[model samples]
Target: MMQEWRRRRQAKRVKPGDGSPLPRFRWWQLLSRSLFTLELVGPDGRPSSYAVDVRQAGDKDDGEVRARLYVDGALRMVSRVPARFPVPGGEIEVVVGGFGMKRCHLVAADGSERQLVPHPRSAEGRRARFDRDHPVASRGVGALSLLAVLVGLCLALPALAETISEIPPVAQAVGTFKSPLNLPGWLLVTVGVAAVVGSIERALRLRSSWIDDLAS
Candidate 1:
């Protein structure tokens, strides 16, 4: 029921395109931009190409983060992140996470879904290619990223608790607390940077876990 409501709401958000050509992705904007494409055959047996483009650095005009859908190289629709654009056979869903995109997939009428392919020169595409060519190494890297985020959570949680406990109101109400795993500032910074990188890496693969993503 809730899902249906959301679909209806998103459907209302859809509007006709302005017929402007889609902008090309540039090499320097690889980290800040994302583009994914899907090719489908319409009911009339015509081939159509759809692309989803998102610029992480919020829109310049309104400073709102948005996703733009392009059809056959022309602008089709635009909406805020976590958008849904209805298409021929399915809807293209776009979602954003803290570090980057969390979802960009084609959801079919039969309920099946497939992630759109990233452009070859994009960061996501490079990562996907690496995974295909070096499965074991890719797995190891993914494991390390998870481990880094987990370690950050373990170390930061206690410190966070202690800091909160030391607040005047909290201390008076619940007593002071000391964290057992205090470390140097340098070490904390190092761990924090690693956690951030790990989170970005996970985002590149469209993988997210509450514990991992939130902690990182």
Candidate 2:
């Protein structure tokens, strides 16, 4: 299938990493950097720590974004984003979303998976802490973000339809279509911006859906 072909193609893009120590996550780089860690049992029955680090600013090579895998603080492998690195028990999967990390998890041989823990100073870490500290408030904020995205989508779909209907080919085929809701430019811009922010908020919690997150 096409999905399997794409996966194989992406796997070919992976390259070995330089053996350098992984840098500590800094508070100032919270927005641009992401670090997630997992502990796995080694063959010797000892625990080994692995870390996945991604820098959105990317490297000097044409701003090519990559994910770096570190084992016990030393660089083990590196590849472009949406990487899969072989590990002791299984593999570490790393994927970047529009706003932040979409997936960062350890997958076991038996098909079990576990999300890596975010660095304490990272935005994701802060969001996790907030959820634990203020469960009710966190739920309210999450609901608001979903509502914002929903409203934005409702507004966007009509405009999109109207625009598509105006295209010559489409107009000739089905005639021009009118949008039911028309709003001022400023309000449309505001809703778009709110939707973007809401999507980012959801990204902080590693939440993403093609329709809800990408559509808006």
Candidate 3:
């Protein structure tokens, strides 16, 4: 029953797409756009293809990013992220993070899920290729991203606590506080930048935790 409500809510977000053709991904759009494709067989055993495209750096006047769904190479549906489009056997879900996409997968009715294949020219594809070609280096990079998020959290929590403790009412109740890890202003800024970079790296791999996302 709850799942049905969720499906209905997600379905309402979808709007009919213009009868326009899908755009070709270009080299310059690698940083701004993401495209992924899924292949499946219908119940009748007919093969069908679907594509999910997102423009991360696009305008957010509507207060959210949008994901466009294409069926058999024609535009079919579009919805704001985190989007869920009902398909043959399940739904195509798209979610976003601070820097880019954090999730893009097909969720089956039986609760199984699989990520879609990214376009070969896209950044995600290149990153995946890097993982295949240099597993050790890729793992090292992933480790660094996690480390960066942890360090950022360590740096952020104390600062946040100190700020809250400094408030007049809070100070009166709990006394003033200072973060022990205070370096310089410039260093704090540098760490913040690193955290953002780490968040982006994690998103490329479709990995993020609430804590890491909050810290970044």
Top candidate, metric lDDT:
1
lDDT of 1 by residue, 175-198 (tens): 999999868999989998898888
Model 3 lDDT per residue over 10-120, tens place: 789999998678899999988888999999898889998899999997556764579999988899999987799888998899988777888899999999999999898
Better of 1 and 3 by TM-score: 3
> TM-score of predicted model 3?
0.90
Looking at model 2, the pairs that clash are none
Q: Order the numbered candidates by TM-score, best leading.
A: 2, 3, 1
Cα displacement (angstroms), candidate 3, residue 3, comes to: 6.5
RMSD of each: 2.4, 1.8, 2.3
Candidate maximizing TM-score: 2
Q: What local lDDT score does residue 4 receive in model 1, on the 0 to 100 scale?
A: 86
Off by over 4 Å in 3: 1-7, 59-64, 166-176
Please give the range of 10 consecutive residues that has the lowest summed lDDT in model 3: 56-65
In order of appearance, the predictions have TM-scores of: 0.88, 0.91, 0.90
lDDT of 2: 0.85
The per-prediction tally of clashing pairs is: 0, 0, 0
